[model samples]
Each structure stands twice: as structure tokens, then as C-alpha cells.
Target: MELKINRPTKGVELCLDLEKRSQWETLEARRTELAKDPTIDQRLSGGPVTEVAREITQLEKEMAAATVTFTLTALSHREWSRFKTEHPPRKGDKGDEALGFNEETIFDAVIPVSIVSVAGPDGEPVEWAPEKWAPLADEMTTGQYGDFKRAAFGLNLGEAAARLPKSLGASLVMARSDES
Candidate 1:
């Protein structure tokens, strides 16, 4: 029987390319030099120092992009809707009514998905087709899901992903993937 197993994994690394690293290093040096300048007055230090700091930050981000690898997953329609509702900055211009998630909420959701790793059954890995893991992820109990969510919150998204089933009653699902 052809089968596939989806799992979550923890931890990721950010890599930087040589050119980006050089730019980041130059910015870092500029920032350090600005920080040590004794002649700069607090009032006048804002513009120059702030500009250098911002450029440094931008370079750092560019470096991370050059080196870090992030995974992307396609969310099901229902999942997408749920995510949007749960983490929101709804597209409306109502000053009094603000129903939306800030950076923290977005990170909470993104970190979890970014760490998910799907593997096929002892074969070439395939894209985790929709409706496969969704049913199982849905079958998980509320508390079990909470535990999983907590892991994601802690930024320990995918490590020891196998333990998910033990937390959720495995018997609930007849089988993870069905090949008819």
C-alpha cells in the first residue's frame, strides 16, 4: 500500500551569504563607531545614529535571507479562514473596532507551520496533500492540541513530533492516510 506520513520538526538555522555578510559587517562597524562617538549630542544623535541603525538592521535581515532556509506549507481553505480569524488585522477602517493579532500571534502561527516536515513512507518525500493530515490534526483532542500549540509557542515546533499521537488518542483515527 502506498502511504505517507506527515510530521513536525523543531529548530532551524539562518545562513548568510558572503556579500550580505560583508554588508552586514560594514553596517555593524558603522553602528559601533557611531555608538562610541562622544562628540555627538543626544538631541542631534537621533538622525544619523537612527539611520545607521536602521540600515544595519536591514542588512542583518538581508544576511539572514541569504543563509536561512524556511519551509512553506499550503493551508487548507478552512485552516486559512481559521488562521485569519484567530490572528487578525481585519481589512476595515474602523477606529473603535480593532480585531487583529499583533506580531506575537503571527509568529505563533508561522513558527509552527515553518517547522512542519512531511515524509512519505520509506520513499521519495511528497508534498503533504491536503485532507490527509488535516483530518488527523482535527481528530486530536483539545488538550492534546493545546500541548502541541504550546510547543509551537515555545518555538519548539517540530522536535519529537512523533509524540503527537501519544498525546492525541491514536485509536481515534482508523488510519492516517488511505489508499483505495
Candidate 2:
């Protein structure tokens, strides 16, 4: 007898697990309620609420610094070149790469040049565009940009197979689902 194994045609997806994310909100609400309760202190309740509250704080911090994964469909070499040339790297005060521009700029440029998509909490893929990212990118602090830069670099480098590690890399993967 011959047995057949079914394989799921895997595809790249990027998005927060909605149910998991909702836990953060739920924790916040519980913390608020605990704070409002009277006689809910270590002295009376053996610090159960206090311990839970502390856990919530730690979880919130983790959420803030969480490394979100993004799947980017790279652009073609021709489009990549145009994007880099259009957004030339700015020189620093000492004629070096500008502060917060080198990696940050590259990551930001990747958005417009690539087809970036994210998944919903339900694991549904949602396509994102440069316009959707503009406001968030514009408001990011240098530290936040650093986080984004690292993630973007990893996504592009690994997915593009470093063919064009620099700004002008490959973009032919968009025609099909290819996850590196």
C-alpha cells in the first residue's frame, strides 16, 4: 500500500496574533481594576494582586520591545537603483553617514520599493504600502528606527539571499511566494 502525505503550500505572512495581542489589553484592564480595589495589598491578600500586577508590567514592556516579523516582496534591480538614487544617503557632520539615516533610510526605502504585507491576529495576510507606513516611520524615534532597521535588514538580506545586500537588490520574488 502507498501512503500520500499532504503538504501545506507555505507562504510568508507577517502580523500580530490578535488573540495574543488582546492579552496585553486584558492585562492592562486587570491591572487597572486591581489598582482601584481597596484592601488589595500585600498586607491583606498575601500579595497575589501585587505579583500579578508586576507580571503585567513586565509583559507590557516585552510587548513594547517585541521584534515584529515582516515579509517584504523585494523590488527589481532597476526599481531598487532608482529608489536609492532618488534618496541618496545624507552626509554626516563629519562627512560620514548621517546619524540615524544609513540603516533607517535603507529600511524606510525598502517599504516603497517592496511589497510589504502583514497578517492580522487571525493569521490573515494584509498587504501594506508605503503610504500606510509613512506616518509611523516619520514619528519613530532613533531607537525605534534602530529596531525597525535591524528587522528590515534581516528580512531583505535573508529573503533576497543577499544578491543585492545594499539598497539596489533583487525584486523578482514578488511574482511568487518565496520565504527565506
Candidate 3:
């Protein structure tokens, strides 16, 4: 299984290359390999674990390619304002600053994430979170945040990733932003 991960410093020196691969390749590889393994061999089910690993590698690569979304904290008054303007969540009642993730105002920086896996217990396949995700929280103090234990979190990463082409995660992100 080839995988690419997002490391701010490319944390790991060694890694696999799965470029020139498509979703169909991953989908087909697992399907074909598993179909051929009728016994569902423990060593090689080529199921979710394998598939998610492959895709996470791919996601890391894709997310790493992002020219934007770099993590920053301790911004100048101007930089902080600019960041807020760019990621505005919603409009204020009137004469208010745009709202969005303003973590920089408080925290050192928003952690740059690289989603690796979100599979099921069997590791067959499920909804996957993108490396760049708007996480949900239990409290509705501000934005829409989901918990890792939430039912929505149960969707395996594979299923989540498979929907990337259709921008399901994007939908979730926008909604999350609005909720905040």
C-alpha cells in the first residue's frame, strides 16, 4: 500500500509514492484484491485499512500541495485582521467584524492537520476526514464542531474521501464555518 502524508517538516524522512494513482485505482485494487481473497485473509484483506492508508497518503500529498492554508499565530494587528477577513464565518448584526476561525487571536496557531484515517472497527472502509478539516466541538459556544465519537464521525475515512470529488467535506466545512 502506497501512502503520502502531510508533515509540516515532512516529519518522516522515508515514505511511499502513490502518484499517478486515481480513486478508481484504489477502489479497484482493494475490490479486486479482496474479491480474489475469498478467505478474507488476515494478512491481506485489502480492505479499509489498506484502502484508507493508500488514500491518506494521497490526501497528504494533495493537502501538502496547498499554496494557502498555512498555519500562523502571533499575527500583527493587521495580519490578524486579514486572516479573520479571509476566513469569515458569518456576518455580524451590523458594523461588526467578519467571523470565522480566529484561533490566532488566542492560540499560538491553528494546527495544520493531515487526516490519515477514519475507517470502521473492521477496517473495511468508511468516512474519512480530509487533512484540511473544520473540526466540530461538543459545545455550540460558536461554530459547528463535531466530536470524534459523534455518529457522523463513524463514517469511515474511505467513504469520506471517496466523496471528495463531489466536495462532501467542503459542504461540511462550509456548514461548520457558518455554525461558528
Candidate 4:
């Protein structure tokens, strides 16, 4: 019997809930503090810990309901290779070699190709395009953009590959490990 190797077509799903996420974080912090409070007995009915926990659970449901989800798939070997070749690092104005690939450039190039689908909070389909990415990215905070870029890269490359330092050499390493 011959063993067959399938291409990486499976998509990774990532969700973002900006509004409810902050509230969830605040509630989680309150729960942690309540867990340590001597006055608030965790085993007692209607205690602070239990109340905070309940709030957290409710907030989680709300967050899930409000979240925007993205589905991303890995690029084929040829496609990824061509992208890297097209976006090679360049020299600075002073003729110094660039330290690494630009994060924005990487995100801009990779995200559109990697995306399979996008859905809004209500599960309505959201239109996605390469042109839309820059404007959307501009509206996001640095942390938010980083999170999205990380997810996109992680789907196209392995998580380990995505997290690798953004050096020219690192790009080569990622391409070599495309099938992993």
C-alpha cells in the first residue's frame, strides 16, 4: 500500500472580540482578587467569587456572540516561495542592510492570500480583500494588529515558523519548512 501526503488545506479559525474582551479581563481580575479575599468565603452561597465567576461566564458568552471570526489556510509551496522572492528585504537610505522584513509588509502580503473566509458577530459573511486589509489594519491598535497578523501567519506557516524572527534568513527557514 502506498502512503499519500495531502496538501495543507485545513483552515485555522481566529476570533476577535474587542469590546467584551476588556470587560472579561476586568471580571477575571476581580475573580482572582475575590479568590484571595478572607472576607469573601468562596464556599459560601452568593459569595464574591461565585458572583464574579458567574459574571465572567456571562461575559464569555457575550464575547463569543460579538466576536468576528477569520478562517485562514496555508499557502501552497510555490505561492509562498514566490511571495518571499517578491518581498525581499532591501537596503536602507544609508546603504545599510535592513535588519529584518517589515512587519506591516509581511502582514499585508500574507493575510489576503491566507484568508479563507470572514464572519461578523452575527455570523454574517464579511467581505475580505487585499485592498481592505490596509484600511482595516490602520484602524486597529498595535496589539490588535499584531494579534491578527500572528494568527494569519500562524495559519499559513506553523506557529513556530510564524514566531521566528523576521530576518531574511528566517524567511528562508520558513519556506524550507513549508510542509511541516
Rank candidates, lDDT, best first: 4, 2, 1, 3
Candidate number achieving the greatest TM-score relative to the actual structure: 4
Candidate 4 wrongly placed segments (more than 4 Å): 1-6, 9-17, 92-102, 120-127, 155-180
TM-score of each: 0.32, 0.42, 0.20, 0.66
Answer with 3 or 4, whichever has the higher TM-score: 4
Q: For candidate 2, what is the lDDT?
A: 0.53
What are the clashing pairs of model 1? 9-158, 10-158, 10-159, 15-67, 15-68, 16-67, 88-100, 88-101
Tens digits of per-residue lDDT for model 3, 63-149: 344312112112233654555555554444232243244332311122222223333333333344443343322222222122221
Task: Please identify which of the two predictions, 2 or 3, would achieve the higher lDDT against the true structure.
Answer: 2
The best-first sequence of candidates by TM-score reads: 4, 2, 1, 3
Residue 148 lDDT, candidate 3, scale 0-100:
25
**What local lDDT score does residue 118 receive in model 2, on the 0 to 100 scale?**
59
lDDT of 1 by residue, 126-179 (tens): 454434434544654555445444544443223354354463455445355342
Model 3: residue 42 alpha-carbon error in angstroms: 2.2
Using lDDT as the yardstick, the better of models 2 and 4 is 4
Can you write out model 4's per-residue Cα lDDT over 1-180, one digit (the tens) per residue? 999643343333334557777888998998888888888767797877888889999988776776676766677767776776666655552221342344436667887677677888777888877677677667777776676676755655675544534688978898889958
* Model 4: number of backbone collisions: 0
Point to the candidate with the largest lDDT: 4
